[model samples]
Target: MEESQLERNRRNGFLALVLRPINWLKMLGEEVHWSFVIGVMIVYGISQGFAVGMSKVSTMYYMKDEQKVQPSELQVYLGLLQLPWVIKPLWGLLTDTLPVLGYRRRPYFIFAGFLSVTSMLALSIQRNLSLAFSLLSLIGVSAGIAIAVVAIDACVTQNSISHPSLAGDMQSLCGFSSSIGALAGYSLSGFLVHLVGPKAHVDSIPSAARLYCFFSSFYPLHNLSGVTLTSQGVFGLLSVPAGLVILVGMMLKESRVHKFTHRGVNEKFLDAGKAMWTALKFRDVWRPCLYMYLSLAVSLNIHEGMFYWYTDAKGGPSFSQHGLFASKNSNLSLITYHEISSWLNSDSELGCSDVLFWYGMQEVVGSIFSVGAVGSLSGVLIYQNWLKDHRFRDLLFWSQLLYGASGLLDLILVLRLNLKIGLPDYFFVVIDEAISMMIGRIKWQPLLVLSSKLCPAGIEGTFFALLMSIDHVGLLSSTWVGGLLLKFLKVTRTQFDNLWVAILIRSLMRIIPVFLLFLIPRSDPNLSILPEEMLKMKKGDNTLESENTEMVSLVDST
Candidate 1:
């Protein structure tokens, strides 16, 4: 009977491993989770676009000095002003972890929505304000949207962790929603921007020598200039939909997400502090956290490298001149398939929001290719029972090493591939991007899973928020370092071939963390089961002794 029970338990464990969470939406009838995800995506996608349009683009076109604004002036002004976004994570950690009305995800979503919407409305009102005031106003709008973004991310992260089965569906919905936002905003921005003519024809000047005629064709040849850079930094237009989706999603009555009910009382708000301390106490946490930061830094640097590559090697001319903007509107750009005007407009205004929007677009292509990156994790989810037999550390180590190798391979593609044709280079870029995404999926998901499992039942939400904070810090740090690094590298549009070196350095950063991966404590299978079976054995031993004593008494009576 004992052997039979043991065999049955082993079989049950095997089934558990094979059926871990991935299709949570499908399991829940595709109604609740999927609908909510889609609805929020649309709302936020639209909101994100609006946010960019009102704050960044409008501010750019607000008219400077009455003698048509120069792109350089706006660029210089924005360069100094966009610093608020980098520190947003610090405040984000606060809002996400604190509960406003006896719930974690609900109240925060409402606040974020309110801030995001109100800020945009205010910006639209002050569209033609003075330069200093306009710059300040843009910062205000950025603050509101930035706060809202982290709050919404908090919801998705916590929700998915609670329902592991829904991880894949959640990520898919996110992809669809983010991509929609990017597509709509980018496509629209090109057409609506304030047009600056490329020609500068002065009525008083003689036609013999037009001073700016040699500068760019974006301006009329004899007229000297007709183009104008028509923007502030409306980049948020691309991501506004993401925020709108989350805002409306506050309508979702937090699903019955029942694994263990997280502690949600009014007094429980202080747990965020506890979660922070808990995470910090574990020296082991730093190993992977370092890896995450290093990887993001490398990715950002590569992005900078690519920007230089496009300007110098792939595309002709520098953005410092006005003619390029005219060229962009006249179908002289790479993304001509979609007629996105402001993105390439001669006088475009951009905000930091544009960086995030483009990043989201890149992630879409990357997510599709990350299946191999998380292959081991998928196997673990699919064959969870085998995990009882296998060591968790082994799984983690192998996954990180594989990811590291993929990063290196990406470098090779950039350097060695003698793609005489642009199509071949594009193909390699896609592959490299896919590999990078795959490794990220594999590496990052595990961090969430481990934290979710290890966190004490009562403080799960707060603990989860704390983990997210660490993740954000990693990203924020990368942004800071990337800015300085780009400035230092002087990585210009002219030096395209040197991008391979950037790729190689970025790939190499992953190596240091590979050694640290093994230090993390593996999940203990022994603790996850019921102790009632052992208790039953102890009870059975006393009953057998009592029966034996009864038998002895009967024999003595005989």
Candidate 2:
């Protein structure tokens, strides 16, 4: 009887370990509000996931293969696309202060959906790089999805004041929903690239225009498989989610205050401007903003640029017949080719399409079993369970350090150091991506938590938007600076002799931001308004009410 019991216990324990993630997800689902979960799913899943996925793959191959643009030149155009995100304060201001047809959030949501659909449709049909850049920027403006996210987040944050525990649960939902969206996008992007293959070259301008028109109107069937999966088809499919977003927007029920504020459009604009100005003048608000900007500006991300060059470059670890080459400079020397070639052998060079296909496969496998998904899920669980009591500053510092350390994997892969231990190139690539993504997700949770704590009541959307915009600017700056570094180092598709130097510089730069941790506040993660601050906000609300009453009286008298 004892032996039978022990055997049964071991079997149950093994099954539990296998099903732990599903159980965690179920627990999380029960903890969060259903409406919040649904809102995040729609906003992140369809809008952010589908649109971003299609754009990334399409833009990358379109420029690299069709236009034959260099990595540095391509990064500049990508940076230009980030302009809409950088000026997100304007969107926040418009939505916060101004009402459209007696609604603040719904109208913008509809506009964003429509704009996204049109821009994506245009991108699918148009092959002009310049035109593509313009469309990309326009899509950025149609980011009504973000507005919806901000509005929902504000609601959750307000509720958290009374229910402190709800804050972490909601943040977890946001991160989890976002990861789901990203995984879907990442998986589809590569598949689409493989399906579309490469854009054909045309002799005349008119002929190219005609070709685009044909593709726009109808997808050409693939000769080998007799399947229709043109670039236009893929983009058109992506636009369906945007259409769904518009439907969701149309169905949203606005609050009474949102409807009440509808009486004064112009007045709301002035009020919004004033509110933004006031928020900016506050030391607490501006200090974090300044710190985030400065830290992001100095932080380097040449790794992405270098990765592209390394993968596509001939004679690199992935393709070079003679594994690793010795660098004349001691700083560049790491691992030898012979050491790597023992387990990993490169037979041939990979074309652009081949590279994209491999990436897609990696994304697909990574989505299913990668540390990224596991780590993201784990992060939410850890924060909600164990780390909720920990200080934001301390969590952020440690996570950032781990994230920076993950950068070393890129260097190892570049130098074929992983192969020394009998790991295949593809295995190393997947592992590196998983580790980096896991740490990256861990780092993201605290920022969202902190942002929720920092937002004031009245201008929550605008303030959060401003904070998110600053974060995006940091990302954009990284891309732009990385491009410049790549160009300056002469790290091209065929040339990567100085790639190590750029990677080393980026790694060192990642560490510098850790020292500036003093800029962040060490207060409670659930920091809410003090009694005095709440009183001030109540008075401001009263003043607004009085002003509206006076205006109504004047209108009635007239």
Candidate 3:
């Protein structure tokens, strides 16, 4: 009886541990009254997840498998696609400064959703590589997903100024929702990509014509069966999130005051331009922004291209030993694909799709059970419970250092050093991903918290958008630089001889940002300045002047 009771107690403890984060989010949602802020976040989170998953699967697998595009060339296209995100400050300016039909947020949200849906649909049917690239880039631009996200963030930041205790909790909820969405999307993406074979194989029709036919009619009608899911069909299904974004835009309630501004369009644009200039002039805001940019600028991600090359290389260990273990062990079947079409193709050349499949498996497992999910959750908890009081700069430095350390695992794998220690490629990837994800969460949460605190009054959305855009610039630059490095090193699908050189350069680059930590604030702004004190600080700020009267009127009306 006592043993049974102990077992029951253990089970209860496990359940409590699992449900704690969910409960926290529930409490936060109720406290926030499930307002537009929370609603926007949830919808945006899911949409962002779906978009990221779609991009990853399509680029890494479909493009490689179908188009036979080399890694170097693909990287170039990926970098080009980031242009919209890099220029996101323009979107911020337009959304914040210009109102459509007297509504700033709603109309933009609707337009963005419409664009995203249309872009995804176009991607489904288009067989031309140039057109596909253009559509993908259009998705990044028109999705205005970032616009919605930044707007919600601005609302949260404004609310946080008044309710200081809820600031961290609200940010936690945002991260939690985003993580959930990403995990779900990633899981579904793997399944979808696997279901849709890497390249469409039509015996009768030419590949291009068949692709058009599948996307135009066959996919939508669900005519294809068993291991014949078309890429266009998957893309068609992926459009559902954009539809949800449109629904959210139409249904979400916003303040009527947000509907009308006393200023003329010219005045609004002038004020926005001034607001951006004033915000950048502030040491507190632009300092962190500069730091984030520099840190990201110096960071190298050449390892990503290298990893793909390593996996797909014809003579590589992963390639040579692909079927050896699976042939001997029945248990291996549980982890890998079951269908014969999944592993075999007519050409008999080792297909890149198989490598992508296993990689997806690693990603799904790591995202759900191993590191990405658990680590991200724990990151929020750890920050809230133990590290919230600590210096933000110190925490960021440590987290980034740990993140760089995680890259060493990739280096080890690239060097085939893991094989010497009897670590299979699969285990190394899964473990490395788990660790990297956990550290990544730790690194990212503080950055978001800092960005939230840095938003000045009156122009919170515009300023936050600028900050995010700057961050994207860093990412965009990194992607472009990584692609350049691959091209320079001549790292291709077959030739990875110089891959380690690129990896070494990236590893060294990751540590350069650590030395530049002086740019980040040493203290948490929310705690450092009391709410009343913050109001005092804002009194002399010019950017807050244009909207002050309207905000005051809105407050009085409420």
RMSD to true structure for each model, in Å: 16.7, 10.3, 7.3
Clashes of each: 58, 1, 0
lDDT of candidate 2? 0.58
Q: Provide the overall lDDT of each model, using Cα atoms, as 2-decimal numbers.
A: 0.41, 0.58, 0.59
Order the candidates by lDDT, highest first: 3, 2, 1
**lDDT at residue 288 of model 3 (Cα atoms):** 83
Candidate 3: the clashing residue pairs are: none
lDDT, candidate 2, 243-362, per-residue tens = 867776677665534335444656656765676577667765576677677666666767445545544656454321222222223231223323322212333232222211111121
lDDT leader: 3
Model 3 local distance difference test score: 0.59
Top candidate, metric TM-score: 3
Q: How do all the candidates rank in terms of TM-score, highest first? A: 3, 2, 1
> Lowest summed lDDT over 10 consecutive residues: which window, candidate 1?
543-552
Residue pairs in collision within model 2: 324-337
